[model samples]
Target chain A: MDDPEYRAGIIDLLGALAVGELTAFQRLAADAELAPTRADQAALAGMAVAEFHHFEQIRDRLTELGVALDDAMTPFHEPYVAFHANTAPSNWLEGLVKAYVGDQIATDFYREIAATVDDDTRALVNDVLAEAGHADFVVDRVRAAIDEDPSVAGRLALWGRRLVGEALAQAQRVAADRDALTAIIVGAPGRPGMDLAELGQVLSRLTENHAQRMAKLGLSS
Target chain B: MDDPEYRAGIIDLLGALAVGELTAFQRLAADAELAPTRADQAALAGMAVAEFHHFEQIRDRLTELGVALDDAMTPFHEPYVAFHANTAPSNWLEGLVKAYVGDQIATDFYREIAATVDDDTRALVNDVLAEAGHADFVVDRVRAAIDEDPSVAGRLALWGRRLVGEALAQAQRVAADRDALTAIIVGAPGRPGMDLAELGQVLSRLTENHAQRMAKLGLSS
Candidate 1:
């Protein structure tokens, strides 16, 4: 905890999470426009607002740590931008699946990393990552859409797979680019971090959770 | 307050306000994309979320009154849609001006109507219409832009006028289309409503407030 390297790593991790939540807020709000009904739109907007609240929490934490927000958030912007561009949803159902599937995978990855950090940071991560009750809304919408036309399931299943692939690709990009952040997970000098085997297990856990989420949405991962 | 006509009018007004705040959230979120910096984007997103909270309050009030959310919201959707379409901001500065100017005007109108409603409804309206502290951000940004390039002030000023015009136009459409809502403002049987002279005074006050907000943003109304 006294290591400057560890402190920097924690800051890097928090910055990434903060920016990720902000982008999620933006994406969800934009997707709300595709909703078929006002109710659906408001529901998506509610989820977007929830994401913004999470972003605010992380942002305040970063500020409390005396990190200039733009300086911290700037590094991860390109990766997130690329991720969203690659997996832009074509319709409302796709948007719902992306929000649920993509968000769950990211949450799982963060939670895994969070466990390696200090108690306060871990709690902050858990707080932001706590499900905001949007999963049921997304699941209900996606399942109903699939039920309406079984043929749509095949397309959405593929969409879910693409979301996961794009998310993982961008996650890898961030890891390779932000050494401090990767150090938070992979180990820094005088700091305990995930061994290779543990990292493999974390990946598997993320994968399994994503699969379960897709299944909950009646989609094959 | 016991009059069914008055009750229906209150419901109608709440419905219009709920949908208005909901759309305001959507529009602000969409406009956030035009922001030049991440901080600017987050600021707009924050304002959008504030609007969503306002929407939730009004929606809850309508629900408490046993009004269906969609039914209450449905009537004013077209008006709001037209208002946004007619005043779509073309650039970042335009978006800021529209957000600040349009929202302030809407808030003023609602505050006036809230004055005429029951205490509970008036309190709800006041709560939602309270400024969420984004005005300073908008004013700072717009004023800085105008200082940097005086030419923008002309364009944004015109943009501000267009926003007010479109807002008033749609508002008129709503008032004409929804007799119950208008009855709340104009008068119902055995209900004290605004006399024609008072209605004229309300319009003047709204216009005066708009001019002040425009001037605050370094724009002419």
Candidate 2:
């Protein structure tokens, strides 16, 4: 794990994630207009603010690890950008659900990955992930909105599926190409030996969480 | 000055301003997307968040003062809404300037009004105005952007003037109509007014601040 190759890979993955936070903040801030009320706008804007705060911590951690931000983030630039480009949510509720479910899965994935790292990275991960409070707030609002309007149930559930799917696909692509960092997740040198048992465990947990979340909205996932 | 009518008018004016913050946060949050860069978007988002926080305290104070939020804020709402309808910033830099300079003027006006009140109302206004840190941050970004792009100079400066003019017109309307709040500012009923004379003082201070601000940006009023 201390090897140069492993460290390099770790830096790249984190940089991509950091930049992703930056972009999410920008996108959500823009999407806040779709919110029907000032209260709703505040909720989304809170999430957007949290994203940049997350980015700040992650960027600081990258610097602490002696990673050249530009270089560490370079390998990830295109794919991460494309993912957001293709999946930009068009309306208020869609954007809220996107922030909610998308961030839930990402947080789950990050939690899993953090366990695989050494002390420094683990602490940094913990710090950056403190941003989930706003994510939770958004989820409640989205669920409440769906509750107020039953027809929104089907569409948002479907939207949640697409968000999780796109995230999974992009995550897979990152895994395939960034083996150095991917190795850290499975605590193995290669994908062949890497343990996805941990991921399976998380997927089951996330599915349960998602199901409960849907039920909270009086909807079937 | 201690009359019920005067107190009601003061509450009316503040209520309108409070709702204005609420609406501005919503619009600005959505307008954040107009920013061309990640940093710019983050700055706008931060400003939007602060706007929400600003009004929340004022709302809470109104509640403490035995004023129903809806009733207290009812009078100034439509006029302020019309002001926003009449003038909305068209681009990113213009938006930032609108938030920074425009909000600063509003805050200054609020501070002046607060001075005319007794202890609690004054304390509430002072605290509410303190949350403008993010607006200051956004203004710096707008100024830096203008400095970097001389070609943007003329357009932004012109935009800045129009923003101020629209804002000033709204101020005049608020002052002229809210005679009760004006009584609070003028001190005792028959006394010479604080706001009318102080309006000049406030404008002069704003002019000085703007001069320094423009000088820093290498621009002229």
What shift in Å separates residue B197 of candidate 2 from its native position after superposition? 4.2
TM-scores, each model vs. reference? 0.96, 0.78
Off by over 4 Å in 1: none
Worst 10 residues of 2 chain A by lDDT: A186-195
lDDT of 1 by residue, B1-221 (tens): 57878888888888889888988998998898898887898899899999999999887887788878888888888899889888778888888887888898999999999888888989989999998998999999999998999998888888887888888889988888888888888888777899999999999999999999888888888
Across all models, the iRMS values in order are 1.1, 4.4
Best by lDDT: 1
B-chain TM-scores per prediction: 0.98, 0.86
Worst 10 residues of 1 chain B by lDDT: B59-68
